[model samples]
Target: MASQPEQRSKVARRALLGTALCAGLVATLLTTGPARADHRDDAWTVSAPAAHEPTAHIRLDDTTGTVSLSVTRRGRTVIEPSPVGIVTEQADLSEGLRFLHRKDRLVDERYRAKSGKRLDRRVRMNETRLSFATPTGARLDLVVRASADGVAYRYVLPGGYGAVLGETSAFNLPPDASAWLGAYRVDNEGQFAQYTAATAPTGEYSDQALFETDGGYTLLAESDLTGDYSGARLAHDQGTGTYRIELADDRVQADGPLATPWRAMVTGDLATVTRSTFTDDLAPASKVPDGSWIKPGTVLWTWLAGGREAGQSLAAQKAYVDYAAERNWPYEAVDAGWYFKAGEWDTTDPDWQTNSWMPELVDYARAKGVGIIVWIHQRELDTPEERAQWLPTLERWGVKGVKIDFMDSEAQPMLRWYDAVLAETAAHHLMVDFHGSTLPKGIQRTWPHVMTLEGVAGEEKRTNTAAHLTTLPFTRNVIGSMDFTPGAFQRVGLRPNSDAAEVGLTVAYESGLQMFAGTPESYDRRPLARAYFDQVPAAWDDTRLLTGRPGREAVLARRGGDRWFLGGVYAGAARTAEVPLTVGPGRWLVETVEDGADGLVRNRRVLRGGDTFAVEVVANGGFAGIACRWRPGVTTCHR
Candidate 1:
């Protein structure tokens, strides 16, 4: 997340990645950057469900005060313990801590998502507790929450500890294990790529580092971050042959009643991990009393149709407003040049008058049924007074949201600043899209108004390849909605995707701010496909991963209202695929827009639960469809 002074450079530095923005402390850690205890035993194992046969085990080693983990599906150990260790200023969890008690319980609950891929969210897990006490009188609770899909554990500081020194939860994988390392060292939001477990880089991280073994897969991520705590990244430990998690900085003083973010590792099939709601399940409930004002919809961006030459002009913006109105798109962005060109950094500047025209544009967009969203550099929102002055004006003008960009740092202070902006914006009933941001750790669950983030190598990266498209759905987008700015129907080299892949991408990405990155003319060329694009909503009632292999191929199903949308995309090879229909028990009418021998074609059929339909995708191509309960006018045959 870049500041106002660096907006230009930040935009120019178009590396990919994004998520919700938070603020707390703002300091940088060393570019290069944890303890040892031994916990290796199968005896400490426990299954996800008490009544079922155990497939995986979490072994706690009291012998050396450490831990080890494994999954039977993979045969060998998945985690060899980068030596189960936790470091702090006044105490080392590894040393002088004795097992005090142990307990286990079954948890089954459900919650609704303020805005998410699914409305009916469920949590089914068997929790295990292991209490430890330090000779220094500091106590810690090691809690593990296990579900059929995966497992997550966190350190609960019961008391008697000093500032956090970080933890040493390194992952030791089997020989054949490979991982999708999202190495943070890669300049910006690092892209995820496959590497042999041992060959994967050490001392780097992608916020959600995904490791796949012959057994299935395990997703390692941090969640539910609260006050005075540091975000963590992985650091490779050569001596231990594992990737140790290092909190952002050195041992900073941590207040009591603190629990480290869940050191979560979910093991399951690719689809299970992809569809897991663990991130949102980890966050605190929404603070907004009434979030009905928050919404998800498609937006039109003028930058695509008008470039730098026409982008900032009143006439070009009006054209975008016209386009949005014509397409029934809900919002239009007045990106980067309404207020000082650099945005409302200091209203005292002579250029402040330039923002006077914003009221007029907002009025025009509103008359056309399109809400306006303006852009501002993160620094412009650094102060409450500044936000009070700026956002109120936008809200008064009936603006729906703001694209706050260039929040280029991830320090604690920066994190706090992000929260401040979100809170301030929510109060005014304006939504947000964070650009030049970090990964989402269920902040959308906490702040429903935060629509999306720019933490993935999305269409904006003119340098991205076809492979980038296949990698994002599993890695960066896994945690939550991202501001990928998808919907490009041009050539792969030009940073757009094939028209065949366009519809799939539209349904594939979940964002409150759903906008395309291509020219209006380019999108207009595919009128048939536009039917799905125009009607599809950004948020969903449910999501289903029918079949997929990260970066290889994916068949996804999502529900919105009574309609179910399906999309299938593949990497570099053409292949036949089958998608199990997830519609309710009743027979449903299905409409498909998929690749045909000559060109893309539309087909209709009737299908029901447990039935699989054939879908064919070309190399670097995709297919899309929609299904819903039978209607009289729509063609449907007996199933």
Candidate 2:
């Protein structure tokens, strides 16, 4: 095996090789010297693939050498001109630079996503590279890609290396724009709130900063985040309606030519924003050796209900495993106390002297076709040696997956460690669920084995309400899979939502690895809820936003296999939500679960594609259901 430094050298070599491949594809406009250019020549524009898609215009201030951009959907402004630049250790590329040359290309490609809103996707973009030289002649390139859904740009240094100090990038919202944003937390667990851009608090915000603009909606996010660069957040300037780029770390080193993560903004109406695949489109292709072993499904988790005691108890785990097998759930997660104490990783804690029974439980679960996912704190596998020492051992024990928690950082080292862990986990054919982690940047596309991530304030947070729960679909979950472990039959969080609302979340919130948070007894008590869970899928082949808003209400219909599941959540006052059945025209058998005057109710009906499925709700209520296309002679609908 090669040393860490040697592996990094190989990565650098691969990056250089990629750079070489890019050079061949790029048609560079070369110049013998600094060309004196007019303001007209300073601007370049690109439109998305479709006629109605968003268009981006990039303009360079020839005098200050600073670049800025503006965007529009249809004819209305989506973004006011926003500044873009970067500051490095050796030179300041933000201003006082010279125009060198540029390149342009049209990119169109198709790929298969192992899981997400859509199983297959087409990435079409108009790519433009604007090159510049600092006062010291250091090269900087602003690469922009305009797609049908939105536009994204990133900084690249062709032969650049050294410390990246900061960036001058900013997203300028229109004066009347109202923003929905979450505060930045190491675990990325913050509730989203609404405020006018000027009134938005001046502080760090999670990467997925969404705005309801004058024209439509726009969601700010980043993609292709590698460990080579630190994670970034939006630093809002109160009263200015401008969000500046803030790196998670003070300094990040670029060992080779640095290609920063794509600063993406997905634009359009609520449906467009919710259904866009721009994040996955911008990520790299799959890197796993074979994705056949990777499975996405629901897992019965004991920690949330039974806590550490049940998680470590062999009897408790065996019981949970038995329930999982009975329910046909693919896995059961044992959190925290199953291993050593939080900080002590090398040796088992004296409290759990008989922890060796984990292997026995793994065998027991495997016999029933259930996999066991064990949790470990971040410190346990902080280094490659620790990961190497433990990963194979767990595989040998027949453990199918790992739930690594408390990462809480996206600095260069931690980011690199994330990449390394995903790679290593895939090599061992172990699925991974990252908890206490940063918002996913489409890593699932690069490593399909990355089943899920806990970047939102999920069921674990006591402060959660229907308002916070309802906002996630448009904000946090838009970018990638979220492990917001749904299905809590017991009342949870601060102002509790209706039980029907909890049932609705199983389908509304998308996660490749959805963990049922309720206890076996809780689920057993609610037969209807259990029935809904039994049919809902973690991954989808197609998804559509049937109707609703961000924090108030959200109704989504997702297709998995031959069934389309509908889930809707409402935060405030009660009203009737009418969702159009747009899945296609045919005799459809619909089974719905919703809040009744009593506890909960289930109803079955038949509807055609053009018909509407309306449900009456109480305040802070919700609904979940399944629709199957039925044949004329079919005797029964499976789900």
Top candidate, metric lDDT: 2
Q: Lowest-lDDT window of 10 residues in candidate 1?
A: 25-34
Compared with the true structure, what per-residue lDDT tens digits does model 2 show for residues 1-639?
642223433454454445432332232322322455333477888788789778888887878877888898887888888988776555556766666667889889898877778788888998988777654455678898888788999998754445777777888987568888899998899889888888987778988988988669999999999898999888776787888778887778877778999999999999989998898888898998679988888899888779988866889899999999999999899988776445454255443424578889999999999999999887878898878877887888888889999999989899999988888888888989999997778788898888888989888788887888889999888898888887777744443588888889988888888899998888888888987888788889999998878888988899998889988899998888787888888779888899898777987778888788779888999999888887676543444
- Candidate 1: Cα lDDT at 209: 75
Off by over 4 Å in 2: 1-40, 341-355, 492-495, 632-637
lDDT of 1 by residue, 1-639 (tens): 422213322332232113211121001101100022222322455466733322446555655645544444435344554345565544556544555556788788777665567767877777777666544444567777767766667777633345665565656666457777776742236666777677765456765777776657778777776445666677653333466666655544566656777766666677777777777777677778898888788887755546554545777788888988998989888776555444333367655535467778888988989888888777777888778778887788788888888776655566668778878899999988888875677788888788888877776666665566766777777778877776666544765345667778877777778877667787777665666677777888888887777767767888888788887777776767677886678778888878777656788887777688887777778877888787667673211
What is the TM-score of each predicted model, taking all chains together? 0.85, 0.92
Deviation from native of the Cα of residue 566 in model 2, angstroms: 0.7
Computed on alpha carbons, the lDDT of every model, listed in order, comes to 0.68, 0.82
Poorly placed runs, candidate 1 (over 4 Å): 1-63, 67-82, 103-108, 158-161, 185-188, 237-241, 308-311, 341-355, 490-492, 576-586, 595-600, 606-611, 630-633, 636-639
